[model samples]
Target: MDATQPELKRALGLLSLTLYGLGTIIGAGIYVLVGAVADRSGMSAPLAFLLAGVLAAFTGLSYAELGQRLPEAAGAAAYAREGFKSHWMGRIAGFLTLAVAMVAAASVARGGAGYLLTMIDIPLPIASGGVIVLFTVLACWGVKESVYAAGAMTVIEVGGLLAVIVIGGPALADLGVRLPDIWPADLNGWGGVMGGAFLAFFAFAGFENIVNMAEETQDVGRTLPRAVVLSIIISAVLYMLVILIAVLSVAPDLLAQSDAPLCLVVDCEKSTMAFFAPVALIATLNGVLIEIVLMARVAYGMARRGWLPKLLSDVHAGRRTPLKATLAVGAIVFALTSFVEFQVLAKATSAMLLLVFLVVNLALIRLKQVDPAPHLAFRVPNWAPVAGAFSSILLLGAEVLA
Candidate 1:
């Protein structure tokens, strides 16, 4: 191990960190999974999102508190190591965190490719594979550069969602008339709502990604926790409104049918599709970029901690990024995006994240017991982790049973 390895540069401020948080959290899930969620939950898709938001909130608090405490690169792994007093558990957590990034990126890449096909005539493998390559190069460029790119794309994606709300204005007017259509009519309908929430859980996956950026964030104890909470809250509100408009403007059945569901929100006309396909493509691309960055950082961090190979921790002195780790993570995702279909990848992602969330929540619980009153750490009430753990179990069990 090189004792004098260069550290990650701390160049991120509150706004940049917050935008990165939003970009990651809001990326893949809302753009791709919304239709899959609406298909099952029907008019009640908004409620399913709301429920998922609440579940994510409890876990988000756990993350925020832990970030304030550890603020390390492989965040969940650090939390596990500190809380459990075991190096192996930390390694397990680190690899699981890496897996989450890979699987999430794969699914996002696949979903983005579907939208890209609508505007350009290209083979599916080429579209998805090209995105992974382009973004991975951007990630290795530098932290500030990658984030600036991600932040710009985040603004455009947020604007795209607001546009959907405006375009679907007439549907909001009839939301009252549509209210009766939303509630579950029977056991089958309720089952769909439950199943839909499980899928929507994948939509809320990005909040935890912010914690991994802690090593590069200035004043991480203060900045990262705030970013985690703010991003989750803002994303939840946007997700509900957009899904509401989507279900109301078009039949859930029709939404379920299209690859680019949001384009179909305003009727999927040529002009609308022209505007939206690009925006949707940008949103998905931003997600892939962020996750690529995340996996590299985690690999570097784990290597630094001796959980992964020492080679991964070697930073590019000129670029000041994890060059080797970035390439390794990107190559894996480039291959993965071309394999599994989007929904299967999404479900697998959701299940894995739920388990990670479950373990993370438990970690916080154990950490609180070990150091009950750490000074200046962001503190959540004791019930937060408890609720987080139980809710994770509930969702995981529902997914298994259904």
Candidate 2:
């Protein structure tokens, strides 16, 4: 950028961005979807999460290579443009990213409102919209401010997960007996696990969001790739342990029934309700905030590349943020949250994300073919994106047939 132009401040380092990465994947994804996955796979819930994690890793590696190869705010869009050699493809990718981010944020907000209503009576629209408005203000204030809030919230949420593990830890003693149930030996059992993996895949959606922050991150090539890989590995490990504990502590059917699955793990019967309410709220809010920040950067990136209105490309002088873009994205998120049901939003968001991943992985494959010169800081195996693309297609097909 020219000296006169305001650019995104590169204030994020490894720790902050990695925490942000954790926040993106861990919050609403695991918080809400765990039980649903259990509902599908029963005792084999951990396997479903493991399957999802493996698939995500393939795409995550593709993203790491892409992020290092081209560290831009546009992220997938930039990769699409370079790979397809068409400006039009970049615009398509940008809009797809915006749509997925908004829907994902809305779903998380709607889910958060459910948690809020249990604590106190309020209209769903008001509860959800209020959260969106609050976070939009935070995102526009500054990236550092937003990341700090997110990092603190991430720690709190992680603590909540640790609490669940502790409460359910003893359940593992039954592992010797439960081992047989946890593995699927027959076609019927394996089918259930595959179905669960389809839903579990959605929880892995947020790692790609890390790439959108490339412009605002320090040492883009090194930090972005490492953060992507670290977040996926860490989130994957935590997910398996938590899901295993959850399925063991409670019947898969029982855990499946709860809106707050982790709370069920706490075995809370004494208090007002699930003792985990406060932490769940913060986790949900952190997710929505990350989504809003991601969508704004996508809008700003697209605008800067002449795909959207130039006004969206404009940055706030004092805050060094894409103010108008943030406000616009937040408004869209609120509207969707107010109107759409959580299930519909989740399904749509997951489908769009998979479709985008398919395209992005393909973009990486093509780029790899034409631009083979090594990026020494980061590079995935030649077969990585190929597998990523195939897995995406396989999952999409599986979901459709089911």
Could you estimate the TM-score for every candidate? Answer: 0.97, 0.96
Alpha-carbon RMSD to native, per candidate: 1.3, 1.7
Give, for candidate 1, the lowest lDDT window spanning 10 residues: 265-274
Model 1 has an lDDT value of 0.88
Model 2 deviation from the true structure expressed as Cα RMSD, one decimal place: 1.7
For candidate 2, lDDT tens digit of each residue in 132-229? 99999999999999988988999988887887777778988888998999999898888888888888887888999999899899988889989999
Please report, in order, the local distance difference test score of every candidate based on alpha carbons. 0.88, 0.86
Misplaced by over 4 Å in model 1 are: none
lDDT of 2 at 342: 70
Clash-forming residue pairs, model 2: none
lDDT: which candidate is best? 1
